[model samples]
Target: MALLDTSRTAPGKGVAPLRSAAKAALEASGLPGRKTEAWRFTSVRDLTTADATPAQGGLVVDAAPGVDVHRLQGELPADVAGWLAAVEPTLPNAHFVALNGVLADELVVLHAQGHVVAPVTVTHHGAGEGSVSTPRLLVVLEPNAELTLVERFGGSSKGLTNAVTQVRLGANAGLRHIRVHDVAQASLIGALGVAQERDSRYRSLVVSLGGRLARLDLRVRLEGAGSRCDLDGLYHVDGQDHVDHHLRVEHHAPHATSTQTYRGVLDGRGVAVFDGQAQVTRTGPGAEAHQQNRNLLLSEGARAHTKPHLEIDHDEVVASHGATVGSLDEDALFYLRARGVPREDARTILVHAFLRELLESAPTPLRDELAAALRERLPRGEVTAAMELALDVDEAKGDGIEGDA
Candidate 1:
């Protein structure tokens, strides 16, 4: 067996010391194979084999109000490097982190000083055939500060993307993060790691709509009392596409809270997977955690795998998790059918309704955008046509005999 596996295969670039560090980390943990419980359903075979290329031609982002952006031109800042070290060292996919050291080009450090109502958007789009790019971003929030950070991903379907994001929050800081992956063609392997101090808060909303194979890992460490973390996600896949999301939250201090909720719609031969874990240590007294995953498969060939784990060590902590994968409710669909709703329209309505339950809590403007995007991405089939006809019928009827049926 080769000792230097995918984890240690670092492209020769960057400084020698940094490269050596990456190699050492990868060699220590090694790449996770099929047997790894966290990665059981998703495969990194394509990523390991892709001659990782540095991507070009992505979105241009500038500093927003109340935010300071450092576009690092040469050396990595000490503060940024320290944060990265803290995160990637403990990451399960640290091999990818080491790989990121060589392939990454876009380096930026973002600092939020005061409250900022406007969002800072970073658009990352790739070009060229089978190109690979690593986008590295480090974010820090000073005590009592707040900000909104948005990331949009685009590019070709055959292209592979490796992105790493590191974040740290001072006491009482807050962050609202929104990530939109609207590209229908790109293959993405990305990770975002966060650490929170006392009284801080972190909220993240992830929307995934494209990619031949898309996998993301999110890790949040609550190291302070009164800190909170909330994660919400919506994903849809069709055809032969696949999407996987892995999330982990560690509560190392008392009085911390976290929530993980995600929903998915799969059709055609698409596949989706959700694996999430929340751990409360003995020190994490008064911690509260909850996780839920629900998926709808429209086609017989579509698939979803959901696993939720909650580990608690303290008696004062409360934690629970659940997951379900099923088709649309036949009873509900029957009621719609009886109301003269077309089968296609009924199906689309049910899928959107399932997603809406989660989206309702999102910010109004973002909620509207996400709803529109989901509507556009819904698979069109005979039932969709039937829905359009149903709409036309509703318009002609004029008389509102609509059943709450």
Candidate 2:
């Protein structure tokens, strides 16, 4: 792809060799086609044929207290460089990631040494039309440290934003990650990789709202015993938009647990896809994993593809996976209408309730913003004070709900 513009000088000491390696890998694998197994449901034709240029804009970070943020310019940290190098050779679909390594403007790293009470926000602003932005991020949490991270992608509807994020959690560490994609006419393809240590916990909430073509590949490995993970996602699509989310979680240690829940709302000619897999290795005895995906089709032209898979190599592991696609509950709508509620309002309410479960996983402030955004897109586009109060109560319920098998 001619889009690989290596004009921007390499930024760090060990980064040049890494970029060379990535460029080689990208040349070898190239862009995925419709025949690729993992990408069979999604297409990258828009990305390959966009005639795009290298994006000029960089990322902005609002660093939280107790968290150290660094922009890679000169010498790369040994650990960060090592991690980046290791990731280049093993990724299942390494083209976009290799593209990131080849053309990314800079690397943004967030490190937490102790508990961070506030949230760290990283905003990616894309360049103008006919351009492509490759943003790379790495997060590291020290032993017993706690942190919350928010990653937002937006701007330049006519551009392509391809991002890669890597996370490492030390023993007893905890990380709450939130990703929001609202780039209106843009094409977004990204990957997230995470590794957790003993007693560590990782929780993620992904919100996908707008894009012509948006896809995310998320992979998490629970490498240490007692580690746990929760993955929750909500996607809303309308007017010919296409969105896809593919996730894989590996339970490699004893007692490791994970749960994945995803919901989507499609309207008009919009389409959505959810492919999730949970695997328990032979060593992961006592592992518990569950996954569920549901889609609400809002129109005759709307469509969804849902696939949930579970692989268990240990007889002692507990695992279950399921997916459902259908329209809103007719019975609930009838009940609401019989109670004198307007049909459109009733449908809106049910849609909100269907998405509320996953929205509850977002932070309260973000939840409010997300609720307002979703309300604007739903039918009637109205929200009452009582409805807001009810959402408050739901948020107050916190993360106490059971998420595992």
Candidate 3:
């Protein structure tokens, strides 16, 4: 395979060693192909189309709304610092280097004194001729530590941003990970790998709003008993964009539990794919797992594909998986139109309502910020129509028996 042809296919200079290491990793990890069940929905051919090369682009650090970064800039723990230093050397060879987004060098690490309540935001910006950019992050949560980390990807040029993030959670630690991929009409592809320890909780919420082509691969391992994980994602695609989400949860110890919920909206000729898998090994006897994926299509040409899979080797474990894909409820739309709501507004209201459930499940501050961001992106007419229909529905529901008697 071309991806396996590392020596001749690798790109650029000055990072030869890193590229070599990546090639080894790729070969060791195996190529993502149609034959691979996990990659059945998304193709990795683009990644290996040519020899892998370091992307060229400028990296800028700036402030983005809905993301806060105060905690990452403060003092950090010794172990966390050590880990960051160790991972820093590998940043140059990361695949995100080709995209004109954020760079790994721009990462700011902060130490926590105890439990932290504030959230940190990392934003990406792009300019000029579109190029590939990669953003790398390493986060360490100390023992008994707690914090929320929000990563946002946005760009102005037509380019591809490939990002990789690795997080290590300490024993008895708790982390709330929130990621928002609001890339421009440009393309952004991301892969996130996380390792957790005993009694730690790793919660993640992923929101994909922009990007001409976007894919997220999340793999989480429960290494200790009583360790819990929650994975929630929301995605919206319009125009000709394509979005795919692949998640895998591994229960390595006894008594571990996990819950995953993913929802999406596809419009225009856009396509969306959701593939989720839960693996419970024989050692994980008391493990419990559940996964659900729901999608809504707005146009006849738009399409959505969902697949939920469970691999359970433990007879004592409880597991369930399900997926659903369909368009707006015709009856509901008819009801709204019968009550004087316009057709476009009715569809917009329902679509927003379907997506709001995912956002409402988020933390209050994050949810509010995301709501505003979504509103700003909605077509003005759709937004106006939704607002008017909402008001009309509220008024009609409020005037109970005014004309009944």
TM-score of 3: 0.76
Model 1 bad stretches (over 4 Å): 1-20, 56-59, 85-92, 380-405
Q: Please, what are the lDDT tens digits per residue for candidate 1 over residues 1-405? A: 111134332343433434566666666766677998777888877655655455543545756888888765335678766765665533546766666654554466788888977888887775445666667777889898898888887766577667777888889999988887766676777788898999899999888884687788899999889999999988998898888899999998899999999999998898998989898887646899999999998889989999988988767878889999988999999999999987878878888878767777666577767777777778543454344457657756864356443
lDDT of 2 by residue, 248-351 (tens): 99888899899999999999889898999998877546799999999999999988989999988658977888899899999999999999988888888899
lDDT of each: 0.76, 0.81, 0.66
Q: Is candidate 1 or candidate 3 better by TM-score?
A: 1
Per-candidate RMSD vs. true structure?
Answer: 5.1, 4.8, 6.6
Runs in model 2 lying further than 4 Å from the true structure: 1-14, 83-92, 383-386, 389-405
Per model, state how many residue pairs clash.
2, 0, 12
Q: Can you list the residue pairs that collide in candidate 2? A: none
TM-score of each: 0.86, 0.91, 0.76
Which one wins by TM-score: 1 or 2? 2
Off by over 4 Å in 3: 1-20, 26-113, 126-130, 338-340, 376-405
Tell me how many residue pairs clash in candidate 3.
Answer: 12
Best by TM-score: 2
Ranking by TM-score: 2, 1, 3
Question: Per-residue lDDT for 288-320 in model 3, tens only?
Answer: 999999988777887788888899875898888
Cα displacement (angstroms), candidate 3, residue 30, comes to: 7.1
